[model samples]
Target chain A: MLTKRIIPCLDIKDNRVVKGIKFLGLRDAGDPVEVARIYEEQLADELVFLDITASYENRKTLVNLVEEIAQNIFMPFTVGGGIRDSNDIRELLNAGADKVSINTQAVKCPDLITESSRKFGSQCIVVAIDAKKENDGWQVYINGGRTPVDLNAVEWAKKANELGAGEILLTSMDYDGTKDGYDLELTKNVVEAVSIPVIASGGAGKLEHFYDCFSQTGASACLAASLFHYQEYTIKQVKDFLKGKGVSVRQ
Target chain B: MIAIIDYGMGNIHSVQKALEHFGAKTVVTNNPKDIETSDKAILPGVGAFDDAMSELKKQKLIAALNKHIRQKKTFLGICLGMQLLLQNSEEANKSDGLGILEGEVRRFLDRKGFAVPHMGWNQLKIKNKNCPLLKDTPDNSYVYFCHSYYPQPKDKNIIAAVTDYGVDFTSILWQDNIYGVQFHPEKSQQTGLKILENFVNLC
Candidate 1:
């Protein structure tokens, strides 16, 4: 059966696994390889690493850091941030990434999505749409949610899917750090807009949020950062809770 | 010493790195003489089955490998490397395999809500307790796998470990001196590395 996945996203900056991952027993948590090893031991369903430094460094993608993380991680993972074109996607995938996540680049050159899928297959392409509440409606945010783009969330998801995006990663900035709960309304809307599997990201406080998102939003997976970074919730706990809710998970 | 057969299919660099981490002298070779002279051979591959086998046949090392097995030179195949050691694969349709093991590769059919390509970590259930390669592996331990078509063995004795994916399927195989892991040990965290280390330390 197609089980609901529990993913722990790692945000990389300056070739390190962001400062937020300072969990206990993981003194060198900022190291991508070390943090990845911990997550692998806990049996994370998959992992997603976003490189936030390359944009400032004017570098293409973090190939060196990718090589480091890929050494420790065994399951499928998606790498995103500063992925400009097919060449960048090719390099990351060649370095052992399962899929490439496109946000800013897809908005800049929508054709890159089509080109990437043609070269590396659609299953290797994922479109991550970071969104925030705008006047009672969700608006898309680009450039790591720093720049707000005047695009409707549902419309953006529909367009990205039409362009050959295999999956949609819908993240709500409103609840991102709050840990209130997933934006179920936004998740369900995007899920309805596209035929591809949608992974709901951001705003996961407790195990119930994960269970709620899977049931209400119909999202194939849920990705959390702070929750996992603090060791507040383990992937096994989330999976077991989802299983109790009658949602299928890997045993 | 481990000689990894590199015939344009595997990302031999990572495999080479992993084996060396265990302090094993690993050699990446496409030369038939290397396999003939090496103490043991490792077949590591990624990408499609037909492409990998074409490289093997193109290099004309298939006969050399058969002789190596007959001589009991220990062999290990990883991921698509293991799949290529089977009879045939349905991927790319009508592709001929090395026929080292009796089986055909086929896709995972869904009864309902099943994902294609079964790509993630899955727990392995040990079937044959006497298999030496499975030493120290915990029961129901998870291993990484990323393939659409899995090997279907004609002889049940060849089965080593099986994983349940909608339905139960063979996850590991051992026939005489030949050992194959469908999951990527080089990628599979500690449990996987321990298995690879066990293979390296085997007599």
Candidate 2:
């Protein structure tokens, strides 16, 4: 039986894990390896590390961080945020990333998705879409949800699937940092549109929010950052809550 | 010592890291002598089948591996590495496998409502509970999987476990000193680590 996955995402900036990731397990906010171990202890099925650092020099640090975290933990993890081409994907996978999520570059040149998936298996390529509700439908957002692309969320997801993307990471721009809840309508649209696994990101204020996204939409995995980072809710708590609701989770 | 065969294919770093976590001495090399000398060997692979087989041939590790397996040496194969143990694969046009196991690697059909790559965590239904790799693990344990194709063995007795995507496909295959898992044990979290630990201890 395939179980729904709970993923905790860590955003790395300047070669350090950003956000106040203060925890009993972590020595500091910048310790990606320590933070990753704690999440694994909490039984996170998978992890996603976003390298928000844009400089070439800092990329070396991010690569090193990925290697350290991969060494420390045994679960699959994805690296995203500023991946440009197939070569970039190869470098990170060599460093031990299970998958690479591409957003801006994918929208700029859709061929990047095809090429990356072709070179590396589709299982290693994930296309992330940061979407915001526009006049009538959801429009894709890029550059950390600052710039809006003239693409529909559902259409873009469908196109990504056609291009051989293994999975779709759909983050709702409106729900991000709001801590309200996920855009179920948007998530449902993308999930229904794509044949691959869809990871619902952003929002996730409460435990029920994770359950709501899983039960309401066809998302195979749900991702949260601040909630888990702040220690408000552990991955175990969320999995137990979902398990109570009769949702299949790795318990 | 354990040898991780480096066939110029996928990254074997994570596999090495996982084995090292268990305090096992490991080496990543294409040299056949190293593999033959080690108590255990792991064939870690990713990407296309033809390319991987070509690289193994180029390095002249295929014949060495065949001899090592014939000697009943402890061997483990992971993901594409596991698939390569079969007779042939449908990937990369058409390619012949090592023929160590009598089977063919077939692609997954695009069934309605089922993903092709079969990415994410799924439960393993143990077929042969006596298999050493299933030791210390539950009957239906969740393991990570990422592949568009799976192995179809000619001899079903070698299959230790199976997972259902659209069909009941083989997840783990074992016979004597040889073992293979379709999923990435290095990426399957604690359950994965336990599997690796079991393999390491088999020596």
TM-score of each: 0.79, 0.96
Residue A19 Cα positional deviation in candidate 2, in Å, after optimal superposition: 1.5
Candidate 2 residue lDDT tens string, A65-111: 77887787888899998888777888888888889999999999999
Query: What TM-score should be assigned to candidate 2?
Result: 0.96
lDDT of each: 0.80, 0.88
In model 1, the clashing pairs are none
Instruction: Give the per-residue lDDT digits (tens) of candidate 2, residues B1-203.
Output: 99999886656788998899889999989999999898889998887788788889889999889988998999999999999999998885656999999989999888655766788889899999999999999988889998989999999999999998879999999989989999999988888999999998885
- Per-residue lDDT tens digits for candidate 1, residues B148-189, read 668888999989998888888888999989998888777666
Instruction: Kindly list the per-residue Cα lDDT of model 1 for residues A151-195, writing each as its tens digit.
Output: 988899889878877788899999888889999999988887776
The 10-residue segment with the lowest total lDDT in model 2 chain A: A22-31
On DockQ, the candidate that comes out on top is: 2
Docking class of 1: incorrect
